[model samples]
Target: MGTLYYGDAASPIEIEDRALAHVKVVIATKLRRGESFTLSWAHGEGQEPGRSTVWLHPSIPLRFAFTEAEPALLSRAWIEELATSANSSGGLMIVPEPERGGETGPR
Candidate 1:
């Protein structure tokens, strides 16, 4: 698991390392372009059964912490999907990573 520290929130958001890597890429790209958006995800196991959303802005302090020393391999297709959501009116909603080395159905 990985931790996403956004702003000065007392509790960091926990996300799987692979998914977090993809999210990091999209977020950095948007922030670099001075764009702000919302990032939302359904709570995983061991947490309350609900969802959470955060406003991401360039001015806010953000950090990604992974248990592994090195970064995970990123998926271009998944990144594109996330980017598409980021550009949507509803903002970015974290979706499961696509299966590797297999044909995926339409989004």
Candidate 2:
């Protein structure tokens, strides 16, 4: 598991390390381009069991913490999906996907 400590929230948002790593990449790209968007996810099993969304901005403090020692493989297909959403006015939604397009296969 990993936690994304974001904004004024006292509790960090929990996420899988692999997913968080991918999100980190997408978010960093948007921030670098001076864009802002929403990041949303359905709560994972064993958590609060609801959905959440965050308004991401370049000025907000953000941190990513991973439990795994070594970096997990990424999924480019997933990243493309995320990017597409980020480009839309509706913003990004962190829906689940079977990992693909990283070491698993071509993007």
Estimate every model's Cα lDDT from 0 to 1. Answer: 0.89, 0.82
Query: What is the per-residue lDDT of model 2 for residues 1-107, given as tens digits with 9 covering 90 to 100?
Result: 99899988987999888778778888999998988899988888987778988899999999888898778777878888888888888788876765565543211
Taking all chains together, each candidate's TM-score versus the true structure is: 0.92, 0.86
Count of clashes, each model: 0, 0
Compared with the true structure, model 2 gives a TM-score of 0.86
Q: Please list all clashing residue pairs in model 2, or write none if there are none.
A: none
lDDT score of residue 64 within candidate 2: 85
Model 1 regions lying over 4 Å from their true place: 101-107
RMSDs, each prediction?
4.5, 2.8
**Model 1: clashing residue pairs?**
none
